[model samples]
Target: MGVPLLAIVAWSGTGKTTLLQQVIPLLKARGIRTGLIKHTHHQMDIDTPGKDSYLLRKAGADQVIVASHQRWALMCETPDKPLDLADLAARMDYSALDLVLVEGFKDEPVAKIALWRRGVKGEVADLLDEHVIALVSDENLTIDLPLLDINQPVKIADFIENWLR
Candidate 1:
């Protein structure tokens, strides 16, 4: 079967990463292998400066693979093209993962759980989109969608597991 994908979407400083940090371990406890994709608007470099791999990339190599006994990484320069969610997902090795959790790319047409708080600047009026399957929030609300307490990662994980099934 194809790997299940979900997005945890929220505005900046709304604890999206914090919630994922909690949820990932909970999912692992339940024997679910998870893969993650984090989208950033700013330019980023994974290679260390002055390193051979970094120098190779600096010398105009399109891609560079750095390997060690413990870990390996592939750094590709994509200056002209901007990848969307599907493009980024395709690059992942999903053979060993049960699910892929994406953070950001809120506009992508994927199933998502929105983390909402009252004071957050980007709070939505209602999460009525077809892609928005659930809501996790700090304060209880009278919304029609399925709501889970923001602090309870186990319950949230359960909700995700059920939805995936």
Candidate 2:
């Protein structure tokens, strides 16, 4: 693998983003340069409507890249077909990252960790899938694979660190 990838899959209100927000900084403290890819089902627009970049894109520009001192963004109009996870991950700067944390895209055939909280969605039955390598949950239940605590980001970070090794 060019860059190690892990998918954080969960139910709608399962605190997937919350746990990751806490976990990412801990990984950074451990000298891990992480990259992220988030999948959203909604109609996406990262640019403002009246901005020059947005205006240009509206004017039928197939692809537009806006650059500045701090950062740059690539805006491409691809409504013909949906994007692929592997293809999107391949587009990243592989040499600069130790891991890529993907949020959502549970249906994709990738190594994943299912996140769950006890009271959030009643139970963990719906979150389990074929690709799950581990289960992160609040309540302990019998399972064959590794089970990590949902409340402990440090433990989760440790688990991820071990996985990276």
Candidate 3:
């Protein structure tokens, strides 16, 4: 079976990535092996123009794996079609991870922790839905779900650990 997948979701400029930068290390310190899948709408390239992998890919290589002692990366060309979340997630090495953290895909029907800032775009927590397991914010609301403090990454890590169990 696949490992448990948790999504950290928020609107642009809401600090989804920033919070994850904090939470991931804490999870590691607690001995939790983690994997991450980040979603972005814009086209991105991890290889540089003059790099050998970049040259090989430009020469019509559909996929290429660059391996070294420290690390390895697989680059696949997918210009014609966009892969869905399930397809993308299947690429992960599940045996090496206890959990997978997703950075976006807010509209997907997955268990997610929604983050909101008090004076940001929305006047209310519009992201809350049946799929949301928790809400993290600087401001507290009278909602039924668990409300976590946005500034406290340790407590958020604690909440995630509790959820895992």
Candidate that scores best on TM-score: 3
lDDT measured at residue 1 in model 2 versus the true structure, 0 to 100: 60
Per-candidate TM-score against the hidden true structure: 0.93, 0.93, 0.94
| Tens-digit lDDT track of model 2 for 1-165 | 699889999878888899999999999999999999998878887889999999999999999998999988887788996879998898889999999999999888888999877778546777777888899988788988799999899999999999989
Worst 10 residues of 1 by lDDT: 121-130
> Scored by CA lDDT, what does every candidate get?
0.86, 0.89, 0.88
Q: Itemize residue pairs with steric clashes in candidate 3.
A: none
- The alpha-carbon lDDT assigned to residue 113 of candidate 1 equals 95
Write one digit per residue (lDDT tens) for candidate 3, span 1-165.
398888998887889999999999999999999998999988888888999999999999999998999988888888887657777778899989998899998877788999998767764457877889999998868888999999999999999999988
lDDT of 1 by residue, 1-165 (tens): 268779998888889999999999999999889989998888899988998898999999998989999988888888888777787777778888889999987878899998888887875654346788898999888877899999899999999888878
| Superposition error at 45 for model 3 (Å) | 0.4
> Which 10 consecutive residues of model 2 have the lowest summed lDDT?
118-127
RMSD of each: 1.6, 1.5, 1.3
Runs of candidate 2 with Cα error greater than 4 angstroms are: 121-123
Residue 119 accuracy (lDDT) in model 2: 72
